[model samples]
Target: MTNPSSRSTVLSTSLTVFAPAKINLVLRILDRRPDGYHNLWSLMQIVQLEDELSISLSDKHSSITLQCDDSSLKTDPSNLVYRAAAAVLEHSGRVIGLDLVLAKRIPMGAGLGGGSSDAAATIIGLNQLLNLGWSREKMARVGQALGSDVPFFLFAPSAIVEGRGEKVAPVRIKGSRWVVLVNPGFPVETKWAYQQLSISRTGVRPLSDVHITLGKASALSWESVLQAAENDFEASVFKAHPTLHRVKQKLLAEGAEAALLSGSGATVFGVFRDETAARQAQSSFQTEPHLKVYAVSTTSDF
Candidate 1:
């Protein structure tokens, strides 16, 4: 896995970056903050599933323009990618224009962290393209303002993200495994999922002892990850969307080591020991009309 932040390439007129999707191995919602955002503790892992971003520099024009293969995605400033590019330009105070084309592969609003990944990729791409010479920590500080998950991508392939996603600590998993992601062709809005969770819980829930123990370790074995795997959103999310729960059960039945909803997902993933078992699990969802399945390896590479 190549770390983009450590690249020593000279200035380039164009750059292409791959923004990988992420799954939450363990997501625990903590207290609600005064800012109306919830503090969370999550062990996020990057998967092979990714979106592509191609960026070109234009000195003649002083505007940032974006185009996307997915028409449903906005290409304007409202888009995270565009906002991220704008942020970089603003921070550097450079009078240059940017043209970006995003090739979308990850499902939107599926708890895959596609948009946030793209935003982080943009910052990374621009940093390289313009030769800003910024460190990963500096980029993460800028990314934190865009979205909570954006900072995680800057510190990826795996990390424990805390607070409103500002604090990040990288951790290495001892071994690699295959991930089977199953998205049910529908979106679960993050806001709605948070609301559902709030309504379900009477008050702020405290973090578990297992999570505390997991957090203290710098390196984690697969066995410990499987034992500690859990998502607080599953209870309310599954109640509203029972099919997602069924998808998880099917993954386990097909020989998954651990299976759970990624974020506030309509997408559920199963961790498998090998690609063969992951592919077999993916095949089982083939006949389902509304399900999208992919068998991918877990990656620490950016």
Candidate 2:
């Protein structure tokens, strides 16, 4: 299936971009950096769950306005989407007016990378809308300053992201699989997760070279990926939120090939090869009204 992350539609002066959510199949938190940021090695995959952004040129020069269907989201300069628009304008040195409407579906602070994806979408939409002629490399550089996960969206649907998320290497997967995401209807602040991890660990160790060697391969099979799948934050995060641990156990009980916590998350995802099984697992969560569940497929075209 064509990944929405790489697709956008244009009509007249308006453009619509789809910002697909991402899950970290494998996340290894490396040593804490002197800059107060943690080094990371993660295999990130883009899923079908997405947010939509509609962008149109305005008559007023150097002005930008944003609107969102989700009332909880801010539409001001503090919002990632709005900041992205301003970044694009500043980067291209163009005096253009913009109107942006964001339709959010991805859960916030669920470790789904919704906000970062939206920011990447804005950069991409404006690149085409204004004909900036910037390459993905240029766009990613602009994205990196916005958020650590922002650059990954520019290289979707799958990539090995490292080093505070500035490094991105697209990788080919042998096949696609269905994923069921279960969110406990709460947010896990990424910063808080990091602090917890720091306090929990006596000392930080650098990741072995073997993983880096495996990541450099031209392609990888699902079986191999699953074998290496792990998230370093799970131990610390789950300790704080016991419900998340139960969610993972439930997903495994539902016959998921593998169940894992995605990023520093309140969201846990199950990997399944069978679509029917994935859908069934999704339905099983209906009894729990407090949990949000979605059965989505991984993008085929990396």
Q: Report the poorest 10 consecutive residues by lDDT, candidate 1.
A: 1-10
Q: Global lDDT for candidate 1?
A: 0.89
lDDT of 1 by residue, 73-184 (tens): 9898899999999999999999888889999999999999999999999999888888899988899988999999999888888888899999898888888899999999
Model 2 score (lDDT): 0.89
Q: Please list the residue runs of candidate 1 whose C-alpha ends up more than 4 Å from where it truly belongs after superposition.
A: 1-11
Give the CA lDDT, 0 to 100, for residue 130 in model 2: 89
User: Model 2 clash tally?
Assistant: 0
Location of the lowest summed lDDT over 10 successive residues in candidate 2: 1-10
Tens-digit lDDT track for model 2 on 107-146?
Answer: 9999999999999999988898889988888999999999
Give the runs in model 2 whose Cα sits over 4 Å from its true position: 1-4, 208-210
